[model samples]
Target: MLRFLNCRCLLLAGLLLLAPTVQAARTILIFGDSLSAGYGIRQDAAWPALLAKRLHEKSLDYNVVNASISGETTSGGRARIDAALSRYSPQVVVLALGANDGLRGLPLAQLRDNLTAIVASAQSRKARVLLVGQRVPPNYGAYAIGFHDVFGAVARARKAALVDFLLDGVATQPKLFQADNLHPTAEAQPLLLDNVWRGLAPLLE
Candidate 1:
């Protein structure tokens, strides 16, 4: 009986020591569209998955929750933002929507408003936001330029950090992209992770 009690005491002590480390792990919410959803490749090859791996390798206390979906637009993200916040209760939110919005030539005003609302909602929940920007083809003309600029504008106005482009290094490399030329191949995932890391690192601190 005495030996049993002593074993129980040691187990309790070990659990007490581990309490803080367990509580230290927080959520990082990845909110985006197909670009982030690993559209043409394996899910594990996605940037968000790479982010989780990076966090683990660095021994950071964050877990990544990718709530991204294929064909998701800013309007869709806006409608679901609150639910995502409630579900993840994240410490940091990586906002990467608007690509589909640009592709569809959605009104910039609506895009701006939706993004603003999403950022505001996350901030209100005390989550730091890293807004990831997108760029469309030059063929889209002035609308493409406007779409690209809106992300930076929102980040500035909302006081959020910005990743100027998710495909910064990969975009210009056609061979790095999948056959569709819109999505990056698995090989390009790391570059995407690197792009997001620049803005996301400071928030982790």
Candidate 2:
């Protein structure tokens, strides 16, 4: 009987010792567009999933919640920001939108305003924000430049972490993109995650 009691106590103590690690797991909310939604590839092959795997490998204890959708714009993300924030209560909110807006030639000012609102909302909730920048082809000229500039402007004003361009290494490689030429191929997911990790790692710490 004494042996049984000692064994139970040891088990309880062990569990207690392990409890903090389990409870310390925080969430990272990835809010973005098609690039992050894993557009033409399997969901597990997307950067968000890759990020989760990397975090686990590094023993970071972060839960990555990817709330991305194909063709989503900044206004669309703004509309849903509140609900997402309330639902996830994330420790870090990765704001990666505005690509579709630039592609569609939406007003750069509108894009900036919407993105600013999203960042402000996330920050208000005490979630750290990582603003992922994007760029359009030079053909759009001034519109493209203005659109690309929004990411940095918003990040600077809000004091969020900035990933200057999500497609840094992949953009130059045609094979890294899907046939549509906009979304990334499965092979490019890790590269995308790497770009994001450079900005996100500091926040995780």
The lDDT values for all models are 0.80, 0.79
lDDT of 2 at 66: 82
Every model's TM-score: 0.87, 0.87
Model 2 accuracy (lDDT, Cα): 0.79
Off by over 4 Å in 2: 1-24
Number of clashing residue pairs in every model?
Answer: 0, 0
Candidate 1 segments exceeding 4 Å error: 1-24
RMSD to the true structure for each prediction, in A, is 14.7, 14.9
Error of 1 at 112 (Å): 0.4
Q: RMSD in Å for candidate 1, one decimal?
A: 14.7
